[model samples]
Target: MVKSKPVMHKAGHLFSFVLGVIFVIGGFLATYLKGLPLIEQGKASKNWPTTKGVVLKSKVASHRSSNSNSSTYSAEITYRYQVEGQNYKCGTVWFGSDVSTSNRSLAQDTVKKYPVDKQVVVYYDPQKPAAAVLEPGVFKTTYFYYVFGWLFMGPGILMTGIPLFRWLVRVGRGTDERGENVAGKF
Candidate 1:
């Protein structure tokens, strides 16, 4: 009984690892591409000038309890505006340190800053006017996500591709030699 060498097993592992990495990269790219554009489009659409809106409601929702003493809050805001001669009401929950005066003041300040029935500008997508947000500045933060995404993605693809290429070269050479061996045996 001849024992098969472990090269074939390693080759399979290399192939799987490369494919898995590509799958992850594809997923990230898809998400990043889809998300980045929406952010940009939303920001650009804001340049069209905000339509005046009447604040319908404003409240703070506790997102998480931190250290049992402090908690994170999300600002829930709703407003009514007219789009294409029709009235519409849209609301969104905005979170993050930038949404507030200070990190510690996230929920409280947000709720207080924009009070109910306050007249303010609302930014909405012209194509889908129903999808709107009270805080349009959220798009600015997308720059960081874009930077970090490329940073990790570039290296990940390189690391995965190099090993797979080497494995393919080895497999090709092995198959060529094996075929010669069989021809000689016959």
Candidate 2:
């Protein structure tokens, strides 16, 4: 049983190290793959062509959590615009606008800003006119995923780095003060 304890300890460390690596990868993917694109798109949207559009539907949508007694709110604003004689309907207010928040006031404020039938400027991608948004440019939410990535990466670096650093130190020393080989111990 005593022997098994050391083996189990090593196994646990190995698992944690692997998990940390996964976190690092996941964080990078989240930042670059998911977040960077949104930010870039949002930035590009600022230069997109604009057209007159009317709000067809604007309201706050509430969603309840499945696992807990909690709810989130999101602004569900639908607007329609015409580009080069082609009409397009979209619900995007801004980039990453689909994300819901625990703050109901934010959603409510959005709904109040764009009531139904209100005339608004819609920005559309010239390459794909069907893609559009009411508000352009990167907002605070644009950095959400990018910052989220660092959350995972920070811990991952510590987990993977600490063990590797210890191993390096052991390798450099080769033996402890008592002349006991410590290189095998990481």
Backbone clash numbers for all candidates listed: 0, 0
Q: Rate the local accuracy (lDDT) of all candidates.
A: 0.63, 0.90
What lDDT tens digits, residue by residue, belong to model 1 across residues 124-149? 77778786666665444345445556
Q: Give me the displacement of residue 84 in model 2, in angstroms.
A: 2.5
Best by TM-score: 2
Please give the range of 10 consecutive residues that has the lowest summed lDDT in model 2: 175-184
lDDT score of residue 130 within candidate 1: 81
Q: How high is the lDDT of residue 7 in model 2? A: 81
Task: Measure candidate 2: CA RMSD.
Answer: 3.5
- Model 2 lDDT tens row, 35-144: 99889989999999899999999989999988979899999999999999988899989988888889999999999999999999999999999989899999998788
